[model samples]
Target: MDMRALRYFVEVVRQNGFRRASATLHVTQPAISRAIGQLEEEFELNFLVREPRGVCLTPEGDVLYRRASLILQQADSLASELRDLRSMVSGTLRVGLPPMTGSTFFGDVITEFRRQYPGVQLQIIEYGSNQFAGALSDGHVEIAAAMLPIEGEGFLTQTFARERLALLCSRDHRLAARKKVTLRELSDETFVAFTSDFKVNNLIDRLCNQEGFEPSVSGRSSHLDLLVSMVTSGMGVALLPVTVCRGIRSSRLRVVTVIDPVISFDQALVRHRDTYLSRSARAWIEIASEVLGFHVDPVFVA
Candidate 1:
């Protein structure tokens, strides 16, 4: 019936009892009960049913709680936007980056952002694709450039670029001089891959298996430089995004195309779906899109 009542109801449902909810909301138990009672009276619907340990939501209560929570979040987001507009800009924008993605893809964007928003602190963290979702959700980073397709209920993603993955080998290796190679062609070769948690690691393995044999993964590292360095050392062949490979200035490492089935990783900028984007973060996103020539629409999760 009222925002206060809705807040009271949601808190009660969250804290599981009137006493705890009142304590959490800094309101009295009677006020909480009175608010819940008023909601029931107004809707003529039983919202909560008693449970042994606490209270459980009735079907109606569950539905109302969901809507009320979303409404409250929207209200808070509106306030944040207004507050940012009124204040002189400056806040930390923690950016999550898959190892080496920043330098290859968003390097110019980051520099341009610094020139425009000198007051904003841009903290760059080198993380792998494996931790993109968790890092965003946990507020470890406000924005991230990750290898897609990254799907999670808590994220909103905008595809910036789709880069091809190629076979990288030491110049001395047997396949190093080839123009292009297929997944099956490299099936038996010992492989240097990103750590097992990375999406690229799984993708390489999956494509290899689809070609009928599992890849022989010999070693793993989370760093792009390390992977190529290992390959140059003749440890094994590696698969890496072309953009990343281009940045590796090494005569000993050869970056060749993947034919047969040209595999690629989609690079996207990911943000937490439910968090309010400060003006600073939004500006960074726009700059990234402009610099990368990526046309994207806001894709949100439920």
Candidate 2:
């Protein structure tokens, strides 16, 4: 069967009638009907049911619709991938980032990259943890900055740096006087926590679970700066990455190390195995390696 015929058949099913599909495809109604009829003849199946309101898919048509949808999607993706190759250094680089970490180094890297390749466009998307992983998986982004231990196959990841997670509180809070505090010591205090969607919050939950006590969460914020504001305002204490603490230069807040066990999370750049990364994307990856002072293996290209 001709691919064009298959496309015409799919369009007919989508629009639910020859008239609608013909209008959409810029063809006559009879032409759309002829294409679907040819497809049905080639496949040896009745693909649609005649109805007064609109055409409905038969069982065979439903199966073809599912497969056709995937085939069309893959074809479009292939076209995009081929287009990306011809102009690898000049197209847009879609990047996803978390709010808390990597902002400092990423800003400088982006600036330097733009200076070097002004033709390349940058689309930076800030996503919460719940959305970041899915966005990367669905091809919404070419690369994303994420915390480590991403489970699954068909994904390439490289650790850039390890950030220490510290306990932060307002200077006037009781725990602020200490340079170091244990998880057990903060059991009684009201915690201003990151949302459960974040990896930092997961780490805190695991650590607190290990300590055999659930934290008393007084407040939760998605933004690191907002969480710091809450802590500084004496609403509650928070567990935050050291990178985030660097931004809180206020005298009202103090950073304390978690003793007994120092908690840290590895920051990584993650990409899909099948993604066709542009030259500028690879360049930014190298810049990130330089900024973090680590060597990482590039994803295989074929």
Clashes of 1: 0
What C-alpha lDDT do the candidate models reach, one value each? Answer: 0.80, 0.77
Tens-place lDDT per residue, model 2, 24-131, is: 779887777787788889879898997998888989999987777556645545655676678756767788888877576487777777887788788897776555
* Prediction 2 global C-alpha lDDT: 0.77
Stretches of candidate 2 off by over 4 Å are 1-80, 299-302
Clashing pairs in 2: none
Q: Tell how far residue 16 is off in model 1, in angstroms.
A: 30
Models 1 onward score TM values of 0.71, 0.73
